[model samples]
Target: MDKNKEKRPSFVKRFLRQTPHAITMLFGIIVLVSVLTYILPAGSYDRVLLNGRNVVVPNSYKIITSTPIDFLGLFKAIPLGFKSAADIIFVVFAGAIMFAFMEKSKAVENSVGTLLKKMGFGRKHLLIVIFTFIYGFLGVAVGYENNIAMVPIAAVLSLALGGDLILAAGISVGAMTIGFGLSPINPYTVGTGHKIAELAMFSGYGLRSVLCFIALSSMAYYNVRYFKKITKNPEKSLGKGLDEEGISLSKPIQEYSVTANNWLVLSIFLMGLAVIIYGVFNLNWYLIELSAVFLIIALLCGIVSRMGATLMSETVLKAVSLAAPGAFMVGFATTIKVLMEMGNIGDTISYNLALLLQDMSLYTSAISMAVSQSVINFFIPSGSGQALATLPVMLPLGETLGLTRQTTILAFQIGDGISNLVNPTLGGLIAMLAMCRVPLDRWLRFIFPMVLVLLLMSCVALIVAVATGYN
Candidate 1:
């Protein structure tokens, strides 16, 4: 026997060495939820059509026939989840392809480089503020999930601007998290929550806007401080390994010259954004419509860049391949909800939780509602889905405790939105981190402080909503 021969690692050791892939984790959650159905009783709330949306009727819960998912049914739910989440999956694909095409044209690189150069080195903090606002606005307008496609580009820009990957995540994902948490008009959370509570759409915009400002301002300050620290001593960065991963721009900053064509392409992009805003605010467009808008913009960008048909097709294909795994993860995440519903235990969980909260004071109940929603968000990350599942039980419970429906919605918004930043089960955050090659553990450490600040602010905001009779 050769004494120097290397011994192979055991299978368990090798498996433990590997980070749990996002899809594998989500599938495990689905299986766990399906098993819970057998142990938990089955119940449901009566639903009614309100403003063309299905909303649960208050106090309508009743124990129903059990429908525990069998092994075969659990297997079937994989495809069913993909089908239900198709719209968002395509949105991810379209957004990735659009940005990929822009990268191919060197449009984004040129714009970012030129903007940084113009801002000069001394004013770099201003750039952080600007990007943070833009990302936050996107979150408020659409959603954080829809903005996952932008993470890589933001990473490159941050690196080029003398910042690090964490700074990039802070400005892009962090700002978006703040916006998603406090957005006055985000249809996914605010709109859905309001509809479920039978309140007028966006009726509490004044207070929400104030909260958004405070959250974003604080987040921007945190990002700036971190950026300054990392720029001074790169070795201290939490995401130090991410820099070695080479997620930066392919060419040097000097190579990316801002040409007239670049401005034209950018102008067209802004116009498309305007069109999307109108479509969302007036036309009431959603994931499908937003995807179409992005697809059209991608084509226009290709035309503006004067790329040949084959070149455009190849670029899109490359992007689609790059984004395929993330899109699949989105579908996989949706499976948790599908399994819970199939097991017929979603309402049962809600029913028990409501009963637990029934005896608490209004303040305690509101706080509990927010905290419980945060926990539930781990399993059902989709804002609209969570609202549909929990609001019926929460709304009635709030009313019984002399709480306003608006306060209930506020609790839902805070709980559902803030948890996205930290929840490992959230596909969008996982996808963004994957794009930047940032590990989940490292991100958790870097972001935990901000999470606490945001949660504290959220509690204060909920209290204000209750005291002011926010309805």
Candidate 2:
């Protein structure tokens, strides 16, 4: 039996089993939640979801029915939403390309291998764990750059070490997610959550950092255990390579010629750095548009280095092509938010959940709201949107139940952050997984435990908030 396997079913497990067997399960859930919130009347509640700053009163069925869903209308609206999420896609792609050039140049690989060889860090599992912790920490600091930058390193190192490629990618990508999940200043997640809740910009920073620390620790422990098993019986745990039969450990490392690679590599790295800096500082979209110039620079450099225009054009086009699904997911996700606002789904979900727990004690209300936020996360993947949609409704209930609004906001962040790890629709996770060839089942196996630990920890923290009257 696998040592890490759990014997009993948890609530989340049972719920996941019930999820539709579709590639894009979240989209189906979105449609269902849309109907539930818009079609069903709030029996005794006053408010529904919001549009801008307006309260959606129930019995506004006419407005819901009249929502414009024409093909052209959706087409037009999607670009705007894509524009909103454009910064994220741009940063993700540029960072990946930049990191690719570095790895292609053998700079990162040689550096990591030399460092590991010097330190005798051949215990693959322990090294992975330490790297994961650092990755997670830097994720919060350097933010999304870590994902684009480190994923290739992890993959290359795992290959060189004769270990799991997927495991290496997991440590690097997961750490970056941990930071993005617990961002201090990034407008993508935490900043958006604050805006939604109408709370101070930094209100949830401390709690997020604490949760991120614990979650990363849990992930490291899991990695260490896996490595220990692999160490005990390398063949059985780590499995054989693709060329298993009669294969010797004599594969020649692929070499990139410096003369032919330098200019292209240099152009990619410099341009990527510029874009990431601009994104971090929340500069104008003109900076993102400037990527075209960088692509041109890469092309010119490649041409000068005896590289064909076709190769350079193909590479840049491929990079752009890889980003299309991410852009689409963003637009689709934005539409869900628009629908919720149109149908007043946020208020309905919040108000009813609130009233159901209104009679409970303060700690109970806090716990309940935390759990509710996790559920709300499925429908509203954007942390900010979920916070905005649900906070108004949940905050008032927290007040009535003698719970702190601040605690509720923190709970919201925790729930939203954890879901992003496994939510198939989260473009960053999807792209990272694609790069690593890690299927959803494998990632879920590794991540589910960490998610439970983080969720329970968050609930307990919220309980403490209730006890101390934090706000």
Candidate 3:
């Protein structure tokens, strides 16, 4: 053997061996998306504002000879996305700060102990079920991005229950995604689609409720199965990939107890969440209102915890610093949308997808619509955004194909929703994963199979919606 021979690592070998950082992977996606812009011609429909949202006009698409993104625009997408997502970023930051104070109070942990004791569930499976339903209900009745603040609390609960971080994400992110995807009365997706389909808002609740139950049950069961697997073999724990150190369950110093201070903190936090839900549903509260609620929750928690104003300020600032990475990850994910917008290919994609359904059978068209909605979601990730952009084209297409309006909307919402679970372009899920220190690759590995399952369920539900003429 030659002593001078060096085992130099090949570039391909090293690249395949190393996990790309989240931002690196996201940028690669952005690059691929940007390249597609030049390949697809720029096209769009005129839009009219109804109730403050710009809904696309059907049959209004026209090709535009727009310039493809220059090299400068590639880097500029980051700042553009930040501008577009400013409100979202602020609320997420506020939520993080609020949760930081709540973490300091240790109220969430103590409250969980009290909750477990009160619920009389000695087994952990029930807790998993409850979490899936609780967060799933929030996703059903409320919104997705707003619930991100609760990720840490969920993580702690999962840890305490002897589960890994992935279980926490599955119960929270996976369940919420499913709930919102299939929910009958979900204000954002179903509500928006109904408006576009010209059906009374939330009129077809019966079928959606049944579909939602099936999806939620599947999510809960998956979380329980995952929890059992990890707990059975700690070696299989996905939490091993987490970057943050010192993440483990707290051992009760003495038999668990909640003090007066703990109770006050818990009340304040719960009340704040209640206010958010009510505000979102009734008062149409959004980013600013949500941020204000977080501030109130934090100040009250700090006061009850007897932390001085200065201490609270420092704690929150420290928290903001810790969460800064997650926030930036959000901006990176948002950049994907920003790039698509920069090139004006979103409508082109939608138009082409709509064309695919023209020659298909009714049921085939329905399933094809669901698949198209999933594709559309990659460009415009928001539930309501997809409704505004795609539903106009889809509803007309469905009408032509002898499909009911509800069937069309069902396919739109489900496809748009199930895709969000693994869609790296969704800022909220990406940010939440960053907060939990879960790697994107591992999350996809853990959740992609479930996404496929949910997508299958979604397709079947669409078929049912068509067969029953649900409307």
Each candidate structure's TM-score, on Cα atoms with residue i matched to residue i, is 0.84, 0.71, 0.91
Residue range 161-237, candidate 3, lDDT tens digits? 77888888888878777777777888788888877777898988887888889889988998998888887898977
Q: List model 1 lDDT by residue over 50-106, tens digit each.
A: 666677777788998899899999889989878988887787788877777777777
Per-residue CA lDDT of candidate 2, range 246-323, in tens? 111123333322343554555555565566556555753432544444344444445545546566556555655554
Best by TM-score: 3
Clashing pairs in 1: none
Query: What are the C-alpha RMSDs, in order, of all predicted structures?
Result: 6.5, 6.4, 5.4
Mark the regions of model 3 whose C-alpha exceeds 4 Å error after superposition: 1-21, 116-121, 243-248
TM-score of 1: 0.84
Give the Cα lDDT of each candidate: 0.78, 0.57, 0.81
Error of 1 at 63 (Å): 2.0
- Report the number of the highest-lDDT candidate: 3
Runs in model 1 with CA error above 4 Å?
1-24, 141-153, 192-201, 204-206, 232-247, 250-256, 423-446, 467-471
